[model samples]
Target chain A: MRHTINLFLMLAAFWLLNSGHYSVLMLSLGLGSIVLILFIAHRMDVVDHESQPVHLSTKLPSYFFWLLKELILANISVVKHIWLGNSSISPTLTTVKASQKTDVGKVIYANSITLTPGTIAVDLVGDKIMVHALLEENIQALETGEMNRRVCQVEN
Target chain B: MDVAIEIMSAICLLIGSFLCVSGGVGVLRFPDFYTRMHAVGVTDTLGAGMILIGLMLQSQDILVIAKLVMILLMTLFINPTASHALAKAAIHNGLKPVLDNKERNNTESESSSR
Candidate 1:
């Protein structure tokens, strides 16, 4: 089926990309065997595969650029706080609604927020996540829904 | 031109290796995990990125350049996420930030009196 073909293509593509020294004989034989094995597996109905739901591949770069900007701004804020040497460290926890419908999209969003300084995803409760922010401003940013909207643009 | 490019590449590689070694040393010698992470994170990002850029410059073809860029992208995505996750996990598991001995003593005394 399509799943089998997809898997074979994926593996062969990786192999070809990584092979460095390419030979036509090696390419045909290696890729052929991989496809053959997957074809057999497909006939046996042994592999079940699901595709990713993030369809906006073309928009992914824009999303990434936006995240990078946010990260840089967050870094500046964090550096400023450190320079001030005020360790008030007021940690606040709150739930933020995830705009993405797919599980993968939600995970990516949660992890992206957590990767930025001053924010941590403490827990996921259905469509909302409990996030702990190191400062009040970070939570306010999330509340504004700017990041959520960009992630939704990608997920859609 | 090739010689100049190679020399520049070598210089970059040397600097990158020095940074990586210094970061490793900091990780080993730093007083606490959080401080060590701070040293390691910044140095490693700079070190790996510079090294990759050097290697990319030395590469032969467009395919190699594209592959190197992908590797750089992966590092950019993975490094911050991994460090943040580690820090968050440590905090959630009650890993308190290291305070000076005086502050520690004060905290202990306050807890005991309470």
Candidate 2:
């Protein structure tokens, strides 16, 4: 019930924002579409905690900001290596142990790795994520386990 | 105040453009398939993000800004998933990443499990 309300509010906001006109006819049409979409969504059976993660709400902002910093720093390093020629790069593929227990947590960690410029999470098997890094230190950064810890915080 | 916003916006857009071009360069210059994926990832994440933020600063309409935020969020979530999929598929197809010489011998042995 809470998840449904969450989805409804999100859809309502999305529709209201996208459709600037608030005329009687336009609003009724928008409300109808929203109901129709909600019905389809309920039938699809994806309206669950994973879809509307209310628990992560408070923690997400800090994590997002930290990720943004990580992203910029990684970008700077990558830009430098890109100009420094192929020899400057040390392409390393290594599997890192994901401390995340939940599937959502594991996914967050893997996606965070890929979002950083120099590293890409190639494959996830069990709790291990196969990572491809453009530089050795980038993999070292992952091994340092700060990102993994933050993701775990988000999940728990 | 307005000028400051414009200045920041320009800076962001400029940096975004530079990152995007750098990504293109990295794509061409990098040795193999896997390293090149990182290059493209840079283009979409911070590059597109900065560009959207820059656009957001310039726009007055709340709706337009909201839409730009939506695009940025979608890109952030989608790009990594797509890249991960591409990387996994490539690996499954026996696309080995070019690694340092120290680990070259071990690479073949480890790939069999993935």
Candidate 3:
């Protein structure tokens, strides 16, 4: 029920933000389309916890900020290595254990690793993710499990 | 205040472009597929993010800024997922990552310890 409301509000806001038109005709058309989409989505049965993720609404913003910070730092590290030439880069592949309990949380953790510049989550098998790191430090960073912990927090 | 904002926007755009260029260079110089993905990730995330944020600052219109924010959100969400999928496919295709021995040993030891 909460998921349905959240999905509706999100779709409405998305429509309004994208459609600059405020005319009665345009507004009604937009609302009608939204209703149609909602009905289709309801039929599809995807408006659940994973699809809507209403529970993470309050926690996501802070996690985003934290991710932004990590992204910037990772970019800086990569930019430095790029300028320093290939001799500076030491590519490493390792498996990191994901602590998240749910699939959404695991996806979040894996995506976060890939989102940061230096590491890519190559494969996810069970709770373990195979990561390709551009530098040895990146592997160490993942080993610290700070990102994993934060993602788990976001899920719970 | 307008001038200040303009300067900040320009700086961000400049940095963003520099990152993109470096990413190109990294792709060319890096030896393997996985390393190249890292380079692309830099450009896809921070490079695009900075450029979009810079444009948002210049736009000043609420709707335009909202649209830019939406684009940023989409990029942040989609880019990583695409990268992950690509990497997964590459792995499934038997693409081997270049690994440093020290790091490999370290991770092996750490995993065993756990």
Candidate 4:
């Protein structure tokens, strides 16, 4: 009941914020069905803590900040590669050991590496990841483990 | 204030487009596949991200915001995966690394001394 109510409240708030284009009848019917589906999903445990544990809502702002910083850095690196590197780019394929314990943490780390410029994580095997890097420098950057450390902090 | 916001958003969009265009150009003009990947990977993510943020700022409605957020979410997840796959495929196809001068010199010296 509690989770259902929470879900309902969340959907309602979101609906209200988006009520600009909807007619009154459409609003009620659309929102009513949405709430009903949400309620049912909650009851079935489909949207349980593990699946959508955004319960740590308070930490979200900080996470956003960290993600933003990384994104900005990635953008700059891409720009530099376009402008500076004429025809000289070194490709490196190497495996880095994964340090995180949880599946979610590992996924996050993998995605983060892929998100950055000049580096791609090809395959994530048990405790080791094969990464393709545009430059050896990018590989060295990943070795620093700052991105992985930040993601682990978030997952925790 | 509205005008200022619009102007900034437009600027962002233009810059983002420029980056995307430059990246494509780099891919074409770059010497090899590895260098091209570097150019493409950087520009695509940053350019698309900036464009999305610019679009988000141009809207005030909630659904639009949600969709924009979703776009960012998708971008965050998919872009890196594609890059990774490309790199992996390149390696699997036996794409060799272009050795730099230092490595070449080291190899030469070792072979000569032997």
Candidate 5:
């Protein structure tokens, strides 16, 4: 029920932001569409805890800021390697162990790895994620578990 | 100051353009599909982000800024999913990444695991 309410509010805000319409008829139609969509979503059983992730809401901003910092740094390095030609890259593929307890946490960890330039989380099987990187040092960086620990913090 | 904001916006846009072009060069210069993906991923995340941020800095309307933020959020969420799917598919199709150094020579690994 709480999740449904959350979904409704999110959808309402999304509609208002996108629609820019507040008339009686437009608003009524918008409300109708939102409730109908919510009903369908509830029927599909998709508005659960993981889907809405209320627990993660407060923690996401800080993690995102950290991620943005990592992103900028990674982008610079990858761009530098790009200019340095093919020989400068030392590609490495290896598995990194994840300590996240939830599926969402694991997804967050894998996505963060993939989001950073020069590294891609090729596959996630259970507690291990197989990563491919343009530089061997990148694999070492992942092994340090800085990102893994941060993601776990977000989950908790 | 408005002048400072304008100068910062222009710098952001210039860097963004440079990153985007570097992505294209990386894609062409790198060996294999996977390595090329890292280049593309650079463009997708920071490249698009820097551009959007430059746009945001230049925007006068709050709604425009909100929309730019939404675009940024969507990219942050979706880019990885798309890259992961592409990579997983390549690996499942028996594509092996080229890895080694000091004696390395090859753009695409000339090996398939099938």
Candidate 6:
């Protein structure tokens, strides 16, 4: 039920932002389309906790800010390496253990790893994630499990 | 105030462009596929992010700002997903990553011991 409302609100907001039309006809059409889409979604049985993720609303902003900070730092590191040339880069591939219990949590962790500049999550097998890092420092960063712990926090 | 905003936007765009150029260089100069993906990731996350943020600052309309935010969100979500898919597909096709000496030595020792 909450998920349905959340989806409706999200769709409506998206429509309004894109349309920028507030005429009675346009408004009615937007509402009608939102309802139709909601109906289809409900029929498909995809409107659930994972689909909507309204529960994470409160935690997401902080997590995103942290991610942005990490991204900037990562960009600086990568930029430095790029200028220093290939000799400075020592690529490493290793498996990092993820502590997230749910699929969503695991995905968040994996995506977070890939989102960072120097590391990519190649595969997720059970709770272990195969990661490729451009530098040894990135592998060490993952070994610390800070991102994994933050994702677990997001999940709960 | 307008001038200040313009200056800030210019700075952001400059930095963004620099990042994009460096990412391109990294892609061309990097040894292999996975490393190239990392370079691309840097461009997708920080390069595009900074550019969008700069554009967002220049736009005064609330709708434009909202749309910019939406675009940023979409990029943040989709870029990683696409990278993951490509990386997974490459690995599935038996693509091997170029590893540093330390990792290679560790693997070699462990295999020899067994």
User: Which candidate leads in TM-score?
Assistant: 5
RMSD (CA, angstroms), candidate 3: 6.2
Q: Which residue ranges in model 2 land beyond 4 Å of their true spot?
A: B102-114
Which residue runs of candidate 1 sit more than 4 Å off their true CA positions?
A: A1-10, A32-54, A79-90, B1-60, B76-114
Place model 4 in a CAPRI quality band.
acceptable
The digit string of per-residue lDDT tens for model 5 on B1-114 reads 999999999999999999999999999988778899999999999999999999999999877888899999899899999999999999999997777652164533422322
- Tens-digit per-residue lDDT, B28-96, candidate 2: 877788888988988988889989999999999999999999899999999998998999999999987
Decide which is better by TM-score, 3 or 4: 3
> In DockQ, how does model 1 score against the reference complex?
0.18
User: What residue runs in model 3 are displaced by over 4 Å at the alpha carbon?
Assistant: B101-114
Relative to the true structure, candidate 4 has a C-alpha RMSD (angstroms) of 6.2
Interface DockQ of each model? 0.18, 0.50, 0.46, 0.37, 0.78, 0.51
lDDT of 2 by residue, A24-66 (tens): 9999999999999989999999989888887778899999999
Which regions of candidate 6 are displaced past 4 Å? B102-114
lDDT of 4 by residue, A75-132 (tens): 6766666676543455677889778877767877787777766677777889798877
Residue B102 C-alpha lDDT in model 5:
29
lDDT of each: 0.67, 0.89, 0.89, 0.72, 0.91, 0.89
Model 2: which residue pairs collide? Answer: none
Q: Taking candidate 3, what TM-score does its chain B reach relative to the real chain B?
A: 0.86
Best by lDDT: 5
Model with the higher lDDT, candidate 1 or 2 = 2
Better of 3 and 5 by lDDT: 5
The parts of candidate 5 lying over 4 Å away from their true place are B101-103, B107-114
TM-score of each: 0.63, 0.93, 0.93, 0.73, 0.95, 0.93
